[model samples]
Target: MSASVTSTPVDHAPRVPAAPDTAITAVADMARRARVAGRVLGHAGAEQRNAALCHAATALRDARAELLAANARDVAAFSGAASFRDRLILDEARIEAMARGLEDVAKLPDPLGRVLAEWTRPNGLKIRRVATPVGVIGMIYESRPNVGADAAALCIKSGNAVILRGGSDSINSARVIHAAMQAGLRAAGLPVDAVQIPPDTDRRHVADMLAASGLIDLLIPRGGKSLVERVCREARVPVLSHAEGLCHTYVHAAADLEMARRIVLNAKMRRTGICGATETLLIDNAIAPVLLPGLVEDLATEGCTFRADARARAIVPDLPPATEQDFATEWLDAVMSIAVVDGVDDALAHIVRYGSSHTEAIITEDEAVATRFLNETDSAVVMWNASTQFCDGGEFGFGAEIGIATGRFHARGPVGLEQLTTFRYEVFGNGQVRP
Candidate 1:
């Protein structure tokens, strides 16, 4: 006999106020509209979608000054912490980059309806595995207003609908970008709901989107640890959570001192605010005394602050002391933690203990060591003789990305256009049935 579990009456009681009912209903309705839009987008040819992207790019480029003015209003209104300000500020370069990104995505090969695999069975049956969009994607992100345009363009190009929830600090900027997206969609004869931004900036709307499991196909949280943790905990839907990127760069004993120095300096100081920037530096003890000072001094000269452990401090006595929290922190600023380990094994252990599994790099001429590090480190991107900052989608030739996915399943590493798609099997059988 089989047993079935049933919910009691108390379990079916009236819904408690997890979030406001009105906001929840609005998000739900928007999701429904997006889902319908996604169906239309799914069947639309690549030419049509590409045309939309081209129009969007043109619109953004032509209205750069207007967009900047709107972004300035949002920046002026922000009374939040410096961290929020850091993420929200938009300049002419970023807007131009956003427009160029849309143009790049428009030129790339369309991912929808591509045949992944095809096979024939013994019974003369044919099976085709075709790639399809993931339907409606709910993006809950912080600060960066550019993410609004990037996410919408990527989703539309891949034949999926996007519901963007940007931080309140960039609401005005997001609204302006969203208006451009709508114009693009309308120009291509697609529904404006294909890309929708939240009408309100209330945090409760985020809670509502998180809890809307059935309506939202996938939830992608892009921000700090607290936001990702909250979304992971509260979301009833499948979440592609992007946690803090505690990236690391290991300098092997056999590494070229010059190469290691260059790699370390670029990895930590190239752009501290990006997720792929190295937050920690691990040096083999054999090379620390010989190569440590130069690397530290080089980074310090470039305006990077270091928090060193006991072993690392022994090499540079004047360096600031690193706490247990420092190893665990993802200082998305001009800050990094340094440690001296014995060898590859020790380095691996340290990374497993502290890494967010986002990206890790090793500087070594030894093929065996490089192969081992690449194979062992369970990060989304494992590089050898290169900086961790190379872990970007644009750098990887994907044009642009929604963001890097630190999670294991679905999309790992850079979340590009191809990663945004899911596959389905289409089997063609000639009179085949189960016995």
Candidate 2:
């Protein structure tokens, strides 16, 4: 079954303790309030929802100083992996981008109440598939407090209520950001409960949220393997898995060296911590000798460490040898794996072997080769002559993303406004009965 859906969330809530009993009641109550708010938001017209989004955008922009200040505290107090620390920090540009994301979501066409499809039966019965909200969604994420803003805004725009559980490291920033977003909802006459974060930075509360099966219609996990694995394992509600974006970029024989060099750099280094960053680099044996040196040198110059397979190691003699484990890993940092393949078939086979079905890109000028790679690679997002990083909701014109789904069913790639909706069949009959 598909998992996208939500309603309004609660706001200005105080932080509570992480005790299991307290967490059970508090998270359950949060779900209860969100359910009530979701009903109201579900039927709210486009104008009202759009106004709420605009207010949210304004609120985010106005709260920039406060957000940056809060983020500073969060960053200073953080003592985790540098990759995660990077995700936690929110500078001026990032905050502004969050605000613009809200504005962008506000400008998109309303996803609700639209007819997706229609058909007429022989009995003169007309039926149409119309989009509707999924009711209440539980978003359990770690690090990256901006996810709070993005998730909250997208849930509001899609007519779903979201219950956010940001990482404990980002608890303070989450609380502040959640409050500012709620202020916008309140200002726009929307229910504050329509978008709620945990009252406390409690891990127990996350368990409570996971166990709240019937109350939460869907659960989306956005984080590292451990976090996503825990949610998928414990959540009683349907969980949408983004998985590790073990993304890759294949430098094919037909690839233009210049284009391949640029795309590889951007795909890997543009934002190493993001899920869309290519974790593995595959070069065709036909082009390995010619392309590997320049490309390897370019990335190395930018402080990227390379782990290469035997075939690729021949081309870059000084590169550290990659293990089987390296090809399967999602470095989520500046580290990446490289393998040399024979041709399109070889590259495709390797991707199928190691890909997380997240995103994959092929840098080539030949339409036939690009088409083969795109068709053969079983990733949610397959790119041709472009960076895998483009596999984002905003780039796809969805304002911001809740997360990118790697699952094959329901939704894949970027989960945005349209992906956050469900559908029902509405039938119009002229006093007709089934034969």
Model 1 clashing-pair count:
0
lDDT per residue as tens, model 2, 145-191: 99999999899988998999898888877877787777777777778
The TM-score obtained by model 1 is: 0.93
TM-score of every candidate relative to the true structure: 0.93, 0.94
Cα displacement (angstroms), candidate 1, residue 126, comes to 0.4
lDDT of 1 by residue, 168-283 (tens): 87888887788778767767777777888777887878988988888899888888899999999888999886788999999999999999999999999888888999999999
- Could you tally the backbone clashes for each prediction? 0, 15
Q: Lowest-scoring 10 consecutive residues by lDDT in candidate 1? A: 3-12
TM-score (C-alpha, index-matched) for candidate 2: 0.94
